[model samples]
Target: MASVFLLLVCVGTLLGSAGAQEAYDRLPSKFKLGVDMALEMRNSRAGVKRLLLYFKGLGQSDIQPGNDVTYIYHNFYMKATQCPKGTVDTSNCPFRNIKPEIDCAICYKTIAGKIQASPKPYINCIRKPALTEAMKRKRVNYCNEMGYSSGAPGGLADIGDTYF
Candidate 1:
């Protein structure tokens, strides 16, 4: 009975190791998938908004101007301008009409500085290379933890064959 139990333990260990190796093999492909997803997200308006919000909320107050203020200001300006003059009587104007008049100089300058200071969100506005790099690093670490080589023969394909 003891010998049977030992044999079972060895088999379980081997299976577990093989499963781990298989997982490692798939890491590159998973990394690529993550990168592709990020790229797709970056191309979308909602995705851009989410990323901007994330960066803005991460205590990167500098990015808040561009991500929030500038965007909101522009939208407001456009909406206000869309209404033809005299279309709505000013006597009943609900909100103060500061459009095209107030200048919003401080807000504009602040947003401009934010835009200039950190252009990563803009550059990543289309591709998100930084996110891709982060994903790559994560996959490398995961592969290492699984005792596998990310640069193994056939690269991602080898992992796909075994796992996916």
Candidate 2:
């Protein structure tokens, strides 16, 4: 009976993970663009501290239509990393070992799909308390997959420098 129960638990875990992957795969590209824009906005405001953050995941999102523009609201997560603002290679940077933050923002894009730099999308991020042991353990699997990102897509353009 114990062995049977273990098998069922494993199977359930696999199914749950597969479902999550499928959902992510089906997410609209616009959702990803919103998340990317949110990340950029957050990094831009990371002033004197130079603290840089990486995308964690989206908690919630919604889109509203306007006359000739669309508002994409996003509530997402970002993990603080040891990498600073100018870090050229973030793939080697690990998390700061602290609790991640939840960022909320609303991005305005044109009907033609260009993000408006003017109305500067409203963005705010708040870091929670430190992570407990269990919370850290729960994120172990994400560590390996967290590699590859070397800061925002166009580099630190906020500082007036662009990488090729």
Q: Largest TM-score belongs to which candidate?
A: 2
- Candidate 2: stretches off by over 4 Å: 1-29, 45-51, 64-69, 99-102, 117-120, 129-164
* TM-score for candidate 2, residues paired by index: 0.46
User: Following a full C-alpha superposition, what root-mean-square deviation does model 1 have from the true structure?
Assistant: 25.7
Backbone clashes in candidate 1 total 0
Which stretches of candidate 1 lie above 4 Å from their native place? 29-164
lDDT of 1 by residue, 55-128 (tens): 11100111122233221011000112222233332222122123221100000112332322221121122222
| Candidates in order: C-alpha RMSD to true structure | 25.7, 15.5
- The residue-by-residue lDDT of candidate 2 on 1-164, one tens digit each, is 99999999767655644443444356566666665566666666646244444444544333333454444444455655556766665444444545456544333333456656644444455554553445433332122112112111211112111110
In model 2, state the lDDT of residue 119.
Answer: 43
